[model samples]
Target: MTNLMETLVENREMVQPNHANMLDTAHGGNVMKWMDEVGAMSAMLFSGETCVTARVNQMNFERPIRVGDTAYITAYVYDSGTSSVKVRLITEREDLRTREREKTTESYFVYVAIDEHKEPTTVPDLTVSSEEADRLRREALEGENGNC
Candidate 1:
Protein backbone atom coordinates (compact mmCIF):
# COMPACT_ATOMS: atom_id res chain seq x y z
CA MET A 1 0.00 0.00 0.00
CA THR A 2 1.10 3.52 -0.74
CA ASN A 3 0.10 6.35 1.50
CA LEU A 4 -1.70 9.17 -0.31
CA MET A 5 0.52 11.68 1.42
CA GLU A 6 3.58 9.92 0.01
CA THR A 7 2.39 10.72 -3.48
CA LEU A 8 2.06 14.44 -2.88
CA VAL A 9 4.24 16.52 -5.19
CA GLU A 10 4.83 20.24 -5.33
CA ASN A 11 6.89 22.30 -7.75
CA ARG A 12 7.51 25.96 -8.52
CA GLU A 13 8.52 27.66 -11.71
CA MET A 14 9.48 31.25 -12.28
CA VAL A 15 7.38 32.73 -15.04
CA GLN A 16 10.10 34.40 -17.05
CA PRO A 17 9.70 36.16 -20.36
CA ASN A 18 10.48 33.02 -22.27
CA HIS A 19 7.59 31.21 -20.65
CA ALA A 20 5.11 34.03 -21.31
CA ASN A 21 2.88 34.73 -24.21
CA MET A 22 2.68 37.93 -26.22
CA LEU A 23 0.56 39.45 -23.44
CA ASP A 24 3.39 38.82 -20.93
CA THR A 25 1.40 36.20 -19.14
CA ALA A 26 2.40 32.56 -18.79
CA HIS A 27 1.19 30.56 -21.73
CA GLY A 28 -1.45 27.93 -21.20
CA GLY A 29 0.74 25.30 -22.84
CA ASN A 30 3.57 26.03 -20.46
CA VAL A 31 1.30 25.69 -17.48
CA MET A 32 -0.07 22.42 -18.77
CA LYS A 33 3.42 21.07 -19.27
CA TRP A 34 4.33 21.86 -15.69
CA MET A 35 1.15 20.26 -14.41
CA ASP A 36 1.82 17.13 -16.44
CA GLU A 37 5.31 16.84 -15.04
CA VAL A 38 4.18 17.13 -11.45
CA GLY A 39 1.22 14.88 -11.97
CA ALA A 40 3.44 12.17 -13.46
CA MET A 41 5.77 12.41 -10.51
CA SER A 42 2.91 11.93 -8.10
CA ALA A 43 1.61 8.98 -10.05
CA MET A 44 5.00 7.34 -10.18
CA LEU A 45 5.41 7.83 -6.47
CA PHE A 46 2.09 6.18 -5.79
CA SER A 47 2.56 3.34 -8.25
CA GLY A 48 6.25 2.77 -7.68
CA GLU A 49 6.66 2.39 -11.43
CA THR A 50 7.00 4.55 -14.46
CA CYS A 51 3.76 6.27 -15.33
CA VAL A 52 2.45 7.99 -18.41
CA THR A 53 -0.41 10.42 -18.71
CA ALA A 54 -3.51 8.73 -20.07
CA ARG A 55 -6.14 11.44 -19.79
CA VAL A 56 -6.62 14.97 -18.57
CA ASN A 57 -9.98 15.97 -17.23
CA GLN A 58 -11.36 19.37 -18.13
CA MET A 59 -8.97 22.07 -17.07
CA ASN A 60 -10.06 25.57 -16.13
CA PHE A 61 -7.75 28.52 -16.23
CA GLU A 62 -9.41 30.82 -13.77
CA ARG A 63 -6.77 33.54 -13.74
CA PRO A 64 -3.65 34.62 -15.53
CA ILE A 65 -0.14 34.14 -14.24
CA ARG A 66 1.75 37.26 -15.21
CA VAL A 67 5.42 37.23 -16.07
CA GLY A 68 7.69 37.75 -13.05
CA ASP A 69 5.32 35.81 -10.85
CA THR A 70 5.91 32.28 -9.63
CA ALA A 71 3.82 29.33 -10.68
CA TYR A 72 3.27 27.02 -7.74
CA ILE A 73 2.04 23.63 -8.89
CA THR A 74 0.80 20.86 -6.61
CA ALA A 75 -0.25 17.31 -7.40
CA TYR A 76 -1.41 14.33 -5.37
CA VAL A 77 -2.67 10.88 -6.15
CA TYR A 78 -6.16 10.39 -4.72
CA ASP A 79 -7.35 7.19 -6.36
CA SER A 80 -6.11 4.18 -8.26
CA GLY A 81 -7.33 1.19 -10.14
CA THR A 82 -5.41 -1.86 -11.35
CA SER A 83 -3.11 0.32 -13.43
CA SER A 84 -4.52 3.81 -13.47
CA VAL A 85 -3.80 6.55 -10.98
CA LYS A 86 -5.87 9.68 -10.64
CA VAL A 87 -4.10 12.86 -9.65
CA ARG A 88 -5.49 16.22 -8.64
CA LEU A 89 -3.46 19.12 -9.97
CA ILE A 90 -3.69 22.78 -9.01
CA THR A 91 -1.66 25.79 -9.95
CA GLU A 92 -1.33 29.06 -8.12
CA ARG A 93 0.14 32.38 -9.16
CA GLU A 94 2.41 33.78 -6.49
CA ASP A 95 4.02 37.18 -6.23
CA LEU A 96 7.30 36.46 -4.51
CA ARG A 97 7.75 40.01 -3.36
CA THR A 98 4.34 40.42 -1.80
CA ARG A 99 3.89 36.74 -1.02
CA GLU A 100 0.37 36.80 -2.41
CA ARG A 101 -0.99 33.73 -4.08
CA GLU A 102 -4.20 32.91 -5.94
CA LYS A 103 -5.46 29.80 -7.64
CA THR A 104 -5.04 29.98 -11.42
CA THR A 105 -5.82 26.53 -12.73
CA GLU A 106 -7.14 23.13 -11.69
CA SER A 107 -7.44 19.75 -13.34
CA TYR A 108 -7.47 16.00 -12.81
CA PHE A 109 -5.01 13.82 -14.70
CA VAL A 110 -4.98 10.04 -15.04
CA TYR A 111 -1.81 8.04 -15.47
CA VAL A 112 -1.12 4.43 -16.23
CA ALA A 113 1.70 2.59 -14.63
CA ILE A 114 4.02 0.76 -17.02
CA ASP A 115 6.61 -1.94 -16.62
CA GLU A 116 10.00 -2.18 -18.28
CA HIS A 117 8.39 -3.78 -21.30
CA LYS A 118 6.17 -0.70 -21.59
CA GLU A 119 3.11 -2.70 -20.78
CA PRO A 120 0.51 -1.56 -18.31
CA THR A 121 1.31 -2.74 -14.78
CA THR A 122 -0.69 -3.03 -11.62
CA VAL A 123 -0.36 -0.47 -8.87
CA PRO A 124 -0.74 -0.78 -5.13
CA ASP A 125 -3.85 0.40 -3.37
CA LEU A 126 -3.84 3.97 -2.11
CA THR A 127 -3.97 4.52 1.64
CA VAL A 128 -4.64 7.61 3.72
CA SER A 129 -2.32 8.02 6.69
CA SER A 130 -3.75 11.13 8.29
CA GLU A 131 -6.79 13.34 8.55
CA GLU A 132 -5.17 15.79 6.15
CA ALA A 133 -4.78 13.07 3.57
CA ASP A 134 -8.39 12.05 4.01
CA ARG A 135 -9.51 15.64 3.63
CA LEU A 136 -7.45 16.07 0.50
CA ARG A 137 -8.93 12.94 -0.99
CA ARG A 138 -12.42 14.19 -0.21
CA GLU A 139 -11.68 17.57 -1.70
CA ALA A 140 -10.32 15.93 -4.86
CA LEU A 141 -13.42 13.81 -5.17
CA GLU A 142 -15.64 16.86 -4.72
CA GLY A 143 -13.61 18.82 -7.23
CA GLU A 144 -14.06 16.02 -9.71
CA ASN A 145 -17.79 16.44 -9.30
CA GLY A 146 -17.32 19.98 -10.69
CA ASN A 147 -17.16 21.71 -7.31
CA CYS A 148 -13.86 23.30 -8.30
Candidate 2:
Protein backbone atom coordinates (compact mmCIF):
# COMPACT_ATOMS: atom_id res chain seq x y z
CA MET A 1 0.00 0.00 0.00
CA THR A 2 1.31 3.39 -0.90
CA ASN A 3 1.27 6.27 1.54
CA LEU A 4 -1.38 8.78 0.48
CA MET A 5 0.58 11.73 1.77
CA GLU A 6 2.95 11.40 -1.14
CA THR A 7 0.15 11.30 -3.67
CA LEU A 8 -1.10 14.83 -3.30
CA VAL A 9 -0.99 17.12 -6.32
CA GLU A 10 -1.24 20.85 -7.00
CA ASN A 11 -1.92 22.26 -10.41
CA ARG A 12 -2.42 25.78 -11.72
CA GLU A 13 -3.59 27.34 -14.92
CA MET A 14 -3.92 30.85 -16.20
CA VAL A 15 -7.44 31.96 -16.89
CA GLN A 16 -7.50 32.71 -20.58
CA PRO A 17 -10.19 34.51 -22.51
CA ASN A 18 -11.47 31.24 -23.89
CA HIS A 19 -11.84 29.91 -20.39
CA ALA A 20 -14.16 32.76 -19.42
CA ASN A 21 -17.82 33.20 -20.06
CA MET A 22 -19.71 36.14 -21.55
CA LEU A 23 -19.27 37.94 -18.27
CA ASP A 24 -15.51 37.79 -18.72
CA THR A 25 -15.16 35.62 -15.66
CA ALA A 26 -13.78 32.15 -15.52
CA HIS A 27 -16.48 29.75 -16.56
CA GLY A 28 -17.76 27.23 -14.06
CA GLY A 29 -17.11 24.42 -16.50
CA ASN A 30 -13.44 25.30 -16.77
CA VAL A 31 -13.06 25.36 -13.03
CA MET A 32 -14.78 22.02 -12.71
CA LYS A 33 -12.49 20.56 -15.33
CA TRP A 34 -9.45 21.74 -13.41
CA MET A 35 -10.77 20.26 -10.20
CA ASP A 36 -11.56 16.95 -11.86
CA GLU A 37 -8.10 16.65 -13.36
CA VAL A 38 -6.38 17.41 -10.08
CA GLY A 39 -8.59 14.97 -8.21
CA ALA A 40 -7.83 12.26 -10.73
CA MET A 41 -4.12 12.88 -10.34
CA SER A 42 -4.37 12.41 -6.61
CA ALA A 43 -6.38 9.23 -7.08
CA MET A 44 -3.81 7.84 -9.46
CA LEU A 45 -1.08 8.65 -7.00
CA PHE A 46 -2.83 6.72 -4.25
CA SER A 47 -3.76 3.76 -6.41
CA GLY A 48 -0.49 3.70 -8.38
CA GLU A 49 -2.74 2.99 -11.34
CA THR A 50 -5.48 4.66 -13.32
CA CYS A 51 -8.62 5.99 -11.70
CA VAL A 52 -11.87 7.55 -12.82
CA THR A 53 -14.28 10.11 -11.41
CA ALA A 54 -17.08 8.22 -9.77
CA ARG A 55 -18.78 11.21 -8.21
CA VAL A 56 -18.40 14.85 -7.24
CA ASN A 57 -20.33 15.51 -4.07
CA GLN A 58 -20.51 19.26 -4.39
CA MET A 59 -18.83 22.14 -6.22
CA ASN A 60 -19.56 25.66 -5.03
CA PHE A 61 -18.22 28.68 -6.85
CA GLU A 62 -18.01 31.53 -4.45
CA ARG A 63 -16.51 34.20 -6.71
CA PRO A 64 -15.37 34.93 -10.20
CA ILE A 65 -11.82 34.88 -11.60
CA ARG A 66 -11.07 37.24 -14.40
CA VAL A 67 -8.87 36.57 -17.38
CA GLY A 68 -5.12 36.94 -16.78
CA ASP A 69 -5.63 35.63 -13.28
CA THR A 70 -3.96 32.43 -12.13
CA ALA A 71 -6.17 29.63 -10.94
CA TYR A 72 -4.43 27.46 -8.37
CA ILE A 73 -5.87 24.08 -7.44
CA THR A 74 -4.77 21.58 -4.84
CA ALA A 75 -5.88 17.98 -4.51
CA TYR A 76 -5.11 15.47 -1.81
CA VAL A 77 -6.45 12.15 -0.67
CA TYR A 78 -8.14 12.58 2.67
CA ASP A 79 -9.67 9.13 3.07
CA SER A 80 -10.20 5.89 1.22
CA GLY A 81 -11.96 2.57 1.16
CA THR A 82 -11.23 -0.69 -0.51
CA SER A 83 -12.13 0.57 -3.95
CA SER A 84 -12.52 4.30 -3.68
CA VAL A 85 -10.79 7.41 -2.38
CA LYS A 86 -12.08 10.78 -1.26
CA VAL A 87 -10.21 13.80 -2.58
CA ARG A 88 -10.46 17.37 -1.35
CA LEU A 89 -10.08 20.13 -3.92
CA ILE A 90 -9.61 23.85 -3.30
CA THR A 91 -9.34 26.48 -6.02
CA GLU A 92 -8.01 29.97 -5.60
CA ARG A 93 -7.52 32.84 -7.98
CA GLU A 94 -4.54 35.21 -7.93
CA ASP A 95 -4.50 38.57 -9.63
CA LEU A 96 -1.13 39.32 -11.16
CA ARG A 97 -1.62 43.05 -11.31
CA THR A 98 -2.73 43.54 -7.74
CA ARG A 99 -0.92 40.49 -6.35
CA GLU A 100 -4.03 39.48 -4.53
CA ARG A 101 -5.67 36.10 -4.02
CA GLU A 102 -9.14 34.88 -3.24
CA LYS A 103 -10.65 31.48 -2.99
CA THR A 104 -13.01 31.05 -5.93
CA THR A 105 -14.15 27.44 -5.63
CA GLU A 106 -14.27 24.49 -3.29
CA SER A 107 -15.32 20.90 -3.93
CA TYR A 108 -15.06 17.32 -2.72
CA PHE A 109 -14.79 14.47 -5.17
CA VAL A 110 -14.93 10.68 -4.89
CA TYR A 111 -12.91 8.59 -7.28
CA VAL A 112 -12.80 4.86 -7.87
CA ALA A 113 -9.52 3.12 -8.48
CA ILE A 114 -9.47 1.17 -11.71
CA ASP A 115 -7.15 -1.20 -13.46
CA GLU A 116 -6.19 -1.32 -17.09
CA HIS A 117 -9.21 -3.50 -17.65
CA LYS A 118 -11.40 -0.62 -16.53
CA GLU A 119 -12.65 -2.62 -13.56
CA PRO A 120 -12.78 -1.44 -10.01
CA THR A 121 -9.60 -2.18 -8.09
CA THR A 122 -8.73 -2.08 -4.45
CA VAL A 123 -6.65 0.87 -3.31
CA PRO A 124 -4.12 1.36 -0.55
CA ASP A 125 -5.46 2.54 2.77
CA LEU A 126 -5.15 6.30 3.26
CA THR A 127 -2.90 7.43 6.07
CA VAL A 128 -3.36 10.69 7.88
CA SER A 129 -0.11 11.44 9.67
CA SER A 130 0.03 15.22 9.41
CA GLU A 131 -2.12 17.96 10.81
CA GLU A 132 -3.03 19.10 7.32
CA ALA A 133 -4.30 15.62 6.49
CA ASP A 134 -6.38 15.57 9.63
CA ARG A 135 -8.02 18.84 8.72
CA LEU A 136 -8.63 17.69 5.19
CA ARG A 137 -10.15 14.47 6.47
CA ARG A 138 -12.57 16.39 8.64
CA GLU A 139 -13.50 18.66 5.76
CA ALA A 140 -14.07 15.73 3.47
CA LEU A 141 -16.38 14.11 5.98
CA GLU A 142 -18.47 17.24 6.08
CA GLY A 143 -19.26 16.60 2.45
CA GLU A 144 -20.79 13.27 3.37
CA ASN A 145 -23.67 15.19 4.90
CA GLY A 146 -25.10 11.97 6.34
CA ASN A 147 -25.30 10.41 2.88
CA CYS A 148 -22.16 9.92 0.87
Candidate 3:
Protein backbone atom coordinates (compact mmCIF):
# COMPACT_ATOMS: atom_id res chain seq x y z
CA MET A 1 0.00 0.00 0.00
CA THR A 2 1.07 3.57 -0.67
CA ASN A 3 0.30 6.35 1.71
CA LEU A 4 -1.84 9.06 0.19
CA MET A 5 0.75 11.69 1.00
CA GLU A 6 3.45 9.57 -0.53
CA THR A 7 1.70 9.76 -3.84
CA LEU A 8 1.08 13.47 -3.75
CA VAL A 9 2.41 15.63 -6.60
CA GLU A 10 2.54 19.37 -7.17
CA ASN A 11 3.41 21.50 -10.19
CA ARG A 12 3.56 25.15 -11.12
CA GLU A 13 3.07 26.47 -14.63
CA MET A 14 3.37 29.99 -15.91
CA VAL A 15 0.28 31.20 -17.72
CA GLN A 16 2.13 32.39 -20.78
CA PRO A 17 0.36 33.85 -23.77
CA ASN A 18 0.62 30.54 -25.60
CA HIS A 19 -1.31 28.86 -22.85
CA ALA A 20 -3.94 31.54 -22.58
CA ASN A 21 -7.20 32.08 -24.38
CA MET A 22 -8.34 35.22 -26.13
CA LEU A 23 -9.42 36.59 -22.78
CA ASP A 24 -5.79 36.57 -21.64
CA THR A 25 -6.60 33.79 -19.18
CA ALA A 26 -5.38 30.27 -19.07
CA HIS A 27 -7.21 28.01 -21.51
CA GLY A 28 -9.34 25.18 -20.19
CA GLY A 29 -7.46 22.59 -22.22
CA ASN A 30 -4.08 23.74 -20.94
CA VAL A 31 -5.29 23.63 -17.36
CA MET A 32 -6.63 20.15 -17.91
CA LYS A 33 -3.38 18.98 -19.49
CA TRP A 34 -1.42 20.14 -16.48
CA MET A 35 -3.83 18.45 -14.11
CA ASP A 36 -3.78 15.24 -16.14
CA GLU A 37 0.01 15.01 -16.09
CA VAL A 38 0.20 15.58 -12.36
CA GLY A 39 -2.63 13.12 -11.73
CA ALA A 40 -0.90 10.48 -13.84
CA MET A 41 2.34 11.01 -11.95
CA SER A 42 0.56 10.52 -8.65
CA ALA A 43 -1.19 7.40 -9.89
CA MET A 44 2.03 5.90 -11.23
CA LEU A 45 3.83 6.62 -7.99
CA PHE A 46 1.13 4.85 -6.00
CA SER A 47 0.44 1.99 -8.40
CA GLY A 48 4.08 1.17 -9.28
CA GLU A 49 2.94 0.64 -12.86
CA THR A 50 2.29 2.57 -16.01
CA CYS A 51 -0.97 4.41 -15.73
CA VAL A 52 -3.46 5.84 -18.19
CA THR A 53 -6.40 8.10 -17.63
CA ALA A 54 -9.67 6.18 -17.67
CA ARG A 55 -12.16 8.82 -16.66
CA VAL A 56 -12.42 12.39 -15.43
CA ASN A 57 -15.19 13.50 -13.13
CA GLN A 58 -16.94 16.81 -13.36
CA MET A 59 -14.56 19.78 -13.43
CA ASN A 60 -15.56 23.24 -12.36
CA PHE A 61 -13.65 26.38 -13.17
CA GLU A 62 -14.28 28.59 -10.21
CA ARG A 63 -12.06 31.34 -11.57
CA PRO A 64 -9.63 32.15 -14.30
CA ILE A 65 -5.84 32.38 -14.14
CA ARG A 66 -4.84 35.43 -16.01
CA VAL A 67 -1.76 35.52 -18.17
CA GLY A 68 1.39 36.16 -16.10
CA ASP A 69 -0.19 34.43 -13.09
CA THR A 70 1.06 31.10 -11.85
CA ALA A 71 -0.96 27.98 -12.13
CA TYR A 72 -0.35 26.04 -8.95
CA ILE A 73 -1.54 22.46 -9.21
CA THR A 74 -1.86 19.75 -6.57
CA ALA A 75 -2.72 16.10 -7.12
CA TYR A 76 -2.80 12.97 -4.99
CA VAL A 77 -3.96 9.42 -5.15
CA TYR A 78 -6.75 9.23 -2.61
CA ASP A 79 -8.37 5.90 -3.43
CA SER A 80 -7.87 2.72 -5.41
CA GLY A 81 -9.82 -0.35 -6.48
CA THR A 82 -8.22 -3.26 -8.30
CA SER A 83 -6.52 -1.61 -11.28
CA SER A 84 -7.97 1.82 -10.72
CA VAL A 85 -6.42 4.74 -8.86
CA LYS A 86 -8.48 7.79 -7.99
CA VAL A 87 -6.83 11.20 -7.88
CA ARG A 88 -8.01 14.56 -6.66
CA LEU A 89 -6.60 17.55 -8.56
CA ILE A 90 -6.85 21.20 -7.70
CA THR A 91 -5.51 24.30 -9.41
CA GLU A 92 -4.97 27.69 -7.93
CA ARG A 93 -4.00 30.97 -9.49
CA GLU A 94 -1.25 32.83 -7.68
CA ASP A 95 -0.69 36.49 -8.18
CA LEU A 96 2.56 37.35 -9.89
CA ARG A 97 3.53 40.09 -7.46
CA THR A 98 1.31 39.87 -4.38
CA ARG A 99 1.89 36.10 -4.08
CA GLU A 100 -1.77 35.67 -3.17
CA ARG A 101 -3.50 32.51 -4.33
CA GLU A 102 -7.08 31.45 -5.00
CA LYS A 103 -8.60 28.19 -6.10
CA THR A 104 -9.43 28.23 -9.82
CA THR A 105 -10.30 24.65 -10.66
CA GLU A 106 -11.01 21.26 -9.11
CA SER A 107 -11.68 17.77 -10.40
CA TYR A 108 -11.20 14.07 -9.84
CA PHE A 109 -9.74 11.56 -12.24
CA VAL A 110 -9.50 7.76 -12.38
CA TYR A 111 -6.51 5.95 -13.86
CA VAL A 112 -5.96 2.35 -14.79
CA ALA A 113 -2.66 0.61 -14.23
CA ILE A 114 -1.14 -1.25 -17.15
CA ASP A 115 1.56 -3.85 -17.55
CA GLU A 116 4.18 -4.36 -20.25
CA HIS A 117 1.67 -5.93 -22.55
CA LYS A 118 -0.51 -2.81 -22.21
CA GLU A 119 -3.08 -4.80 -20.31
CA PRO A 120 -4.77 -3.62 -17.17
CA THR A 121 -2.96 -4.68 -14.01
CA THR A 122 -3.80 -4.72 -10.36
CA VAL A 123 -2.86 -1.73 -8.26
CA PRO A 124 -1.92 -1.54 -4.63
CA ASP A 125 -4.39 -0.36 -2.04
CA LEU A 126 -4.33 3.29 -0.99
CA THR A 127 -3.59 4.22 2.61
CA VAL A 128 -3.92 7.46 4.54
CA SER A 129 -2.56 8.61 7.88
CA SER A 130 -5.21 11.13 8.90
CA GLU A 131 -3.17 14.08 7.82
CA GLU A 132 -3.99 16.65 5.14
CA ALA A 133 -4.30 13.79 2.72
CA ASP A 134 -7.14 12.33 4.76
CA ARG A 135 -8.94 15.64 4.84
CA LEU A 136 -8.56 16.09 1.11
CA ARG A 137 -9.91 12.62 0.52
CA ARG A 138 -12.96 13.42 2.60
CA GLU A 139 -13.43 16.64 0.66
CA ALA A 140 -13.14 14.81 -2.65
CA LEU A 141 -15.76 12.31 -1.61
CA GLU A 142 -18.09 15.00 -0.44
CA GLY A 143 -17.48 17.02 -3.58
CA GLU A 144 -18.32 14.00 -5.68
CA ASN A 145 -21.61 13.64 -3.87
CA GLY A 146 -22.41 17.33 -4.52
CA ASN A 147 -21.98 18.12 -0.85
CA CYS A 148 -18.83 20.17 -1.04
Better of 1 and 2 by lDDT: 1
The parts of candidate 1 lying over 4 Å away from their true place are none
Each prediction's TM-score versus the true structure: 0.98, 0.90, 0.95
- Each model's total of backbone clashes: 0, 0, 0
Model 2 TM-score is 0.90
Candidate 2 lDDT over residue span 31-137, tens digit each: 99989999999989888878899989767789998888989898888888889988888899987778688888887788998888999999987777878767767
Report the alpha-carbon TM-score of model 3 versus the true structure: 0.95
**Candidate 2 deviant stretches above 4 angstroms:** 97-99, 143-148
Q: What lDDT does model 2 reach?
A: 0.84
**lDDT (Cα, tens digit) per residue for candidate 3, span 12-106:** 99999999999999999999999999999999999999999999998889999999999999998878999999888999999869989999999
Worst 10 residues of 3 by lDDT: 139-148
Q: Which candidate number maximizes lDDT?
A: 1
Could you arrange the candidates by lDDT from highest to lowest? 1, 3, 2
- Please report the TM-score between candidate 1 and the true structure: 0.98
- How much lDDT does each candidate structure score? 0.96, 0.84, 0.91
